[model samples]
Target: MKMKVESVNLTDPSLLLRPEPVYDGKPVSAFRNFDDDENDPMKARVRKTYYDMHTNMSVDFVKAKMAKWLKFNHFKATMKEALIKLNDLVDESDPDIDLPNIVHAFQTAERIRDEHPDEDWFQLIGLIHDVGKVMAFYGEPQWCVVGDTFALGCKWGPSIVYGDDSFRDNPDTHNPKYNTKYGMYEPNCGLENLLMSWGHDEYLYRVLVHNKAKFPKKALHMIRYHSFYPWHAGGDYQHLLKEGDEEIKQAVLEFNKYDLYTKSAGIPDVEALWPYYESLIEKYIPGVLEW
Candidate 1:
């Protein structure tokens, strides 16, 4: 049977009530924390979804997984077309960051270049890292892509995207293996041994991996596991990693600074910056990129 996805408002109780962010190991709703000056008060009135971090994701783990499947460039269409499609991607639950979709994608990529002018490849990664997020805009649901990426073996962690209260309605949670922590998986299986949620993060990575030489081993690693905050930040999946996963973990940790810290603040003109990015595409990815 095809997987059944429930159409939910972006503000569905599940998303609003999530324990942490779906991609980074942080809060899903900064509702209460917004007023507190202690946790990043530089900006005012942060959108609640901005707090939606990936408690399950880590920058390092994302790097390792993305290196396995990296993309070379942004959407094949012109930036104008890409922006139209991105704008259509409104989250019913995540009403806070209501900017256009391309804006979000651009902010992430542009932030990288601003901080690390020396790392051209990483800047490239920022451009398209979340492009696959458009799948939801195309018709898929949040459950299919935006959530804690877990193994489908025997036991699943209790803190999945929805957690206990939210997953009460999910059929997958009932399956014996799906409910267990290591469901259908053995110890130290490593993320390579798993399949993640089908989203733009994975899709974009696959595109780059096939394109060849889009990003270095380290940057690719950041692309894949940057959303996997659970492993690196919480060390939840340490049980699934092997001895070989150590070094890459360290590299991903460093990359996280840029991904989260680099906001859409004080940036140059995106339209003007395209020429530089376009040149980088010619140098690294092909002039013709796969959608």
Candidate 2:
């Protein structure tokens, strides 16, 4: 919640447990590989999800979604209630972890807790990072509610899952105002100035701020840009980034390891873990939130 800020010891040995991380037998580099393979059903499903997202997620579409969902009028539920809804969701965009999204949630949270036991806010951030996917239950498609996000108005980044071929059907690709290198933005505009495609990252970030959640600024940045792989993970958008944005990128990268690699980790006892996490939720984001 609103705890006093303490300097984190980045060199803590627990954080280095996985120097070359491997999950369930697959190496870390093997994860997030969006290669198209018709013979592999999981690969096909992942491909189709990104294709649908890149095809339909235009500047207008993102704006319309913001106008529709940002009102926080779709429904109201407590943080625990909202997270429980994820029990029924399976992200089609994910190449790993076919289990219910709730399993991944617990896995991420437990992993964060194990490594950063002192940082309750960081652990809570892991628990609820993907809770915005609850938008799926409220009539949004997985393409709009899940998956990696990119800047909507500029030229698509080279590192986005399927690259240019996937966005061929998107109308924004043909518009001069939105297809240029710096489309609708100035140089060194910084990550905050860019309009990202609609997804759970931005949605949940807004929800936390709108509801007055007291997590530190770094926690909010972790939630907001964790899905922005192209910029943080792929080295794109350097021209648009202002000075000090490197800290944001590093924060997202720090959070990303637990989010991405923990999908294949063993599932935690959600029932047993709830008492601890619920306390943190109560401290930070208690009560029914407008969604």
lDDT of 1 by residue, 1-291 (tens): 112112211232323223346434334444212232334433222222222322223333344435533443334653234434665664322323445555655676776777778888777777655555655654554434443344444443433333343444444457675557676678888876765544455665666576565467877776676655446554556677888787777666666555443333334466876778777766776555555
After best superposition, candidate 1 residue 119: deviation in angstroms?
A: 1.2
TM-score each candidate. Answer: 0.66, 0.92
Looking at model 2, the pairs that clash are: none
lDDT of 2 by residue, 1-291 (tens): 112111111122213444566566777656666656667898878777888999999999999999998899999999999999999999999987798898999899888999999999999999999999999998988999999899989898877777787889999999999999999999998889999999999999999999999999999999999988777766789989999999987788788878887878577889999999999999999999998
Q: Candidate 2: misplaced stretches above 4 Å?
A: 1-18
How well does candidate 2 score on lDDT at residue 180? 95
Candidate 2 — worst ten consecutive residues by lDDT sum?
1-10
Q: Name the TM-score of candidate 1.
A: 0.66
Per-residue lDDT value at 76 in model 1: 66
Top candidate when judged by TM-score against the true structure: 2
Best by lDDT: 2
